[model samples]
Target: MYQYDLIDKEFLADRSAEFRGQVARRLSGELTEDQFKPLRLMNGLYLQLHAYMLRVAIPYGSLNSTQARRLAQIARDFDKGYGHFTTRQNIQFNWIKLKDAPEILDKLAEVDLHAIQTSGNCIRNTTSDPYAGATAEEVDDPRVWSEVIRQWSTLHPEFSFLPRKFKIAITASAKDRTAAKVHDIGLMLRKGRDGTLGFEVIVGGGQGRTPYVGPTINEFLPTDRLLSYLEAVLRVYNRHGRRDNIYKARIKILVAALGAEEFARQVDEEWAKIDAARADLPTAELARIRAAFAKTPFETLPARSDAFETAKANDAAFARFVRNNVKPHKQPGYAIVEVSLKAQEQTPGDASAQQLEVVADLAERFSLNDLRVTHAQNLVLPHVKLDDLPTVFATLQASNLATPNIDLVSDIIACPGLDYCALANARAIPVAQDIARQFADLDRAEKVGELKIKISGCINACGHHHVAHIGILGVDKKGEEFYQLSLGGSGAEDASIGKILGPALPADKVATAVDQLVGAYLNVRNDGERFLDTYRRVGLEPFKEAVYAQAD
Candidate 1:
């Protein structure tokens, strides 16, 4: 994890002090709601359905034990006992009082964390693969580049009042776990043939009223020139993106209005002007940043742990944890353990204060003090030892944080829909809970194989519905909430938008429809094929027929 430097510490402390004053003014009515809204939002405070929601940034979703524990404290003292982990790899406190927000920011600052750029019209949190530094498949840790973007975009004078909110996601893994294709800008890190890591830049990718996959702007930008090229992209968007209509203001719409080739040319032309005037980032600065993120101490051990095997042999619970909670790590005898937030009947991503504290304590005790937040709305203990798996699982179970369904059906991704969000058309949390309950059988979920089910309250794609193997988008028809299903979508090495499954299903019929769809996939899939692959090979007709056949 990247530690804050002295300058960073001073900057955050100053910002926190400023925010505290702003909060006091708002409470005294010196700053009206109209005046304070933007300022509060800029600091990641939202007026939600029930109360204020304070979103805290977990830059590139990386955290150490101290940071995690601070989050636990915030949940305990300021808000309710739990926090919702958002799709942007950030955490949200849903019950924050307007008066207490500044105090919460103070606690966050104690751990070098703040809420800046988590929301409002400027560049938002930059998300990357949760496994960035540790993945065997990455060209480089995308966080290295993400940190650069964070520095450039935070409070950049020119971009603060852009036409609409902006989001950027970067990923280094070949599989695209971060869903880069649907972000405002997506950067895929890759090493050139000359063995230098740069990025394959994609622009205009976003989901909202309009959904778009980013078009490739540069095939192989030199590693050192990333910031320069990004500046070019932002400069173009900041200049030309619509301001007349708020609805039409996103960079995605602007890029689409101009063809991809022309957009690329515009960025290239901008880059040429800037690149000629500015020199490459100094070698020393790069080395300094790189040194800050250099790998944590990794101890070598046997390929597989005999103790882990013995535990698995004796205990079914440990066996389940080994099966689902664990991911292959780059270092021997180490495994990445996913702390599942999608426990049955709870909000999909809510982590109680006690649970958060448990994870923090476990990270400090058993795993390395490092933590990660996945784009799929779960936390990761990225450096857990195989020897400590049983103890960790037991501790997590006691905290109601242990559910051995990392990528399984119960591990759903859903937005804070109509329940809290002002823009949402329907409630997403209840639907997610219903589905989790519907597929409560663990063996049944596992037997069905890997399937990605994403839900959005509306077409904003906050839940990333467009890229799931089974995507559900809620819509309002004659004032009633209904769901439209899509089949064959994926957010991976082979990303594709899903096709709709004919007609919308009523709220009551949704889980049953999903059941039919999953049943159809399981019945027809050929050997060793996942849902997306099977759907791609066989098409939506099979699934659609199964889902709607009852009507006939």
Candidate 2:
């Protein structure tokens, strides 16, 4: 993990002190709610339906054990006993009190973490692959660039207030675990034929009321010109992006209005005028940042571990967990273990204070004191020894973090929805909970195979429902809550927008309809095909017919 430099520490401390004063003013009536709204939002505070929500940035989804422990402390001492991890690879405390807000910020500063840029119209947290350095297919670690961009954009005066919120996600892996296509700016690190590293810049991708897969603006941008080219792209959007209508304010809208070719030409024209040498990082600084993320030490060993094999042979439950939760790592004898936060009937992406502490302890023991937060709402111990799998599994089980449902339907991604969010038109957590109960059987979920069910309370698409294998969006129809369904959406390398099945169904029928969709896939699926593969092969008619056939 990148340690905060002296300047970074001073910046956060100063920001925290300033927020403390702002909070005092708000509480003393010196600042009205209207006056404080933008100020609070700049600091990642939101006034939700029930209470204030505080989102804290976990840069590039990377955290050390110490930082993890601090998050656990925040959950225990400040808000409710748990916090929800968001699809943006950030965490939210949903019940923060106005009085305690500054204190929480100050505490977060102690651990080199803060809520800066977590909300507001400014560039939000930069995210990357959870398996970045550990994965085999990456040409370069995306975190190095993510951190560089993080430093550059933290408080850039030029682009502070864009037309809308901006997001950047980077991925170096062959598979797109970070949903690169659904972000405002997506950077894929790659190596050229000559073996020089660079980025493939994709722009104007986003999901909300409208969803789009960002088109490639530059097929291959030299690594040294990354920041300069990015500045050029942002300059184009910042100048032309709409402000009259908030709905049409995002860069995606601008990109859509102007065809991709014209958009690329504008960015190229802008890039041609700027001096890349001035915008690019110096060689020494780049080396320093890259050194900060060098691969951790690993002992030379055989690809497979005898103890791990023996344990898998002995315990069927452990074997099942290994099959579902453990992933292959770049190192020969290491594995990446995913700690599923979506326990049965629990809110997806939520972890109790105790559960956080348990993960911190486990990471310290088996993962080089480092952990990662996945966009899928799970935690990863990225460097666990294969032999430690059994002990880690047991510890996770004790803490209610080992559900063995990594990519299953029950491992849902749901937003705070109507339960806590004022923007929500209907409840999302309840629907997620109902679906989890409907598919509680582990055997049944495994049979379903790699199903992704994402739910959002509204069209904001915070839950990323647009890219799930099965998507549920809640809407208010004549003051009654109803849910809409979409199928065959995927967030992988071959990203595709899910197509809506039909008209919305009552909230009560959502679980049954999902069951029907699953059954329909099962009935038609060929041997060894997952729900998504089968859906792509068979199309939506079969599933749509099954879901609406019993509609009253």
Candidate 3:
């Protein structure tokens, strides 16, 4: 985890102190609700349907035990006993009181975390591969680039109030775990022909009322020129992106209207002008940042140990966990363990205080004290020694956090739909729960394999239904919940938007409909083919025929 410097500490304290006064003025009736809206949003507070929701940023989803503990404290002291971990790798406390927000921000500041840049029309948290440092396939940790962008974008005077809120996600891995394609600006890190790691910049990708996969503005951007290139892209967007219609105000709309070729040209033209304005990116700066993320001292070990194997043999539950929750680590003797938030019949991504505390303890004991929250809404201990897997598995099993279903059908990504969100048309949680239950059997789920079953209550795609291998969007049909299905969509190296299957299915028949769809996929699929690959080969006609054929 990156430690906050003196400047960062002072910045938060100052920002909180200023916001405290702003809140006082608002609550004292000196500022009306209308007047307070933008200010509060700037501070990461949203007045949703029931109550105020406070979104706290977890930068690049990295945290220490202390920071994790503080979040547990906040959940216990202020709102409910739990908090929702979002797709953005941020945490949202749904039922927040107006007056206590500043105090919450103040508490967060103590741990060097704050909600600033979490909302408003500025660059949001720079997400990356959650498995960045742990993955063997990484070119470099994407958080290195993420932190660079974070420092560059925080309260940037020029781009503060753009036409729409901007998001940037980077990934160093070949597989895209961060959903980089759906961000306003997506940076894919790769080793270029010069043997130096650089970014493949994608622009105008967004998901809301209208979804779009960003086009490649630059195929290769040297690490040194990253900030300059980003500034050029933003400048182009700020000058010409829609201001006439708020709905179409995103850079995605602009890119769509301009066409990718024209958009790339405009960005290139803008780069020549603003590239000179950016300060020379110091090589020492990146090194200093990298040093902050240096690998902690690890105990030397011989080839693979027996504790993991012995546990797998002795305990079926632990075996399932090792299969689902544990991932290969970069270090010889270590592993990446997922503390699943997707337990059956429970709300997806909701971690109670006790669970958070247990995870923090396990992170310290087993993972050298680093905790990461995945974009998939799960807690990860990125450096667990293979020798300690049994103990960690047992402890997590006791808390019911050891469900070994990281990328399975049951490990669904969902948003706080009608239950907490003002924009939701129907409840997404219950539907997710139903889907999870429908595939609760471990063997059956494993057989289904590597499917991204995502749900959104409405068009915002907070649940990321737009990127699912099997996308399920909840819609309102005469006051009843109906689900619209889409297939062949992906958020990885080859990103493509999902195509809708057909008419929406009634809520009651949704799980069965999904079953039929999956069954159809299984029948036509090649040997060991994933859902999307099969869909691509056989096309949607098979899925459409299967889903509608059994419509009762």
For candidate 1, the per-residue lDDT at 150 reads: 83
**Global lDDT of each candidate:** 0.86, 0.92, 0.88
What is the lDDT for 36 in model 3? 92
Candidate 2: list runs displaced more than 4 Å: none
**Cα distance off (Å), candidate 3, residue 383:** 0.3
Q: For residues 1-552, what per-residue lDDT tens digits would candidate 1 score against the true structure?
A: 677889988998899889999999999989999999989998999998899999999999988888888898999888878888999999999889988887888888889999998988999999888987776778887888888778778898888888888888898888898888878888898877788887888888777677777788789888788777888888899899999998799998989999899999999898888853354566677777778779678888887888889999999877887788888888888888889999899898888888888888988887778888998999988888888888888898888888988878878899989988888888788888999999999999888878889899988888988888888899999899999998877766577788888898788888888889889988998989988889989988888889778767
Flag clash pairs in model 2: none
Residues 1-552 of candidate 3 have per-residue lDDT tens digits of 577899999999999999999999999999999999999999899999999999999999998899899999989988898899999899999889989999999999999999987888888888888887888889898888888888888999998999988989999998898989888999999898779978899988987788898888888888888888888889989999888898998999999999989989988887887644345468888788888777677778755888877778988877877887888887888888888899998899999888899999998888888999888899899999888988888898888898889899989989999999999998889988998989988999988888888899998899988888999898999998899998988888878889999999888888888889889988888899988899989889999999897773
The parts of candidate 3 lying over 4 Å away from their true place are 275-277
Off by over 4 Å in 1: 275-280
lDDT for each residue of candidate 2 in 75-119, tens digit (9 for 90 to 100): 999978899999888999999999999999999999999999999
- Answer with 1 or 3, whichever has the higher TM-score: 3
Q: After superposition, how far is residue 548 of candidate 1 from its true place, in Å?
A: 1.2
Lowest lDDT block of 10, candidate 3 = 272-281
Better by TM-score, candidate 2 or 1: 2
What TM-score, computed on C-alpha atoms, does each candidate reach? 0.97, 0.99, 0.98
Best-first order by lDDT: 2, 3, 1
Q: Go through the candidates in order and give the clash count of each.
A: 0, 0, 0
Report the Cα lDDT for residue 128, model 2.
94
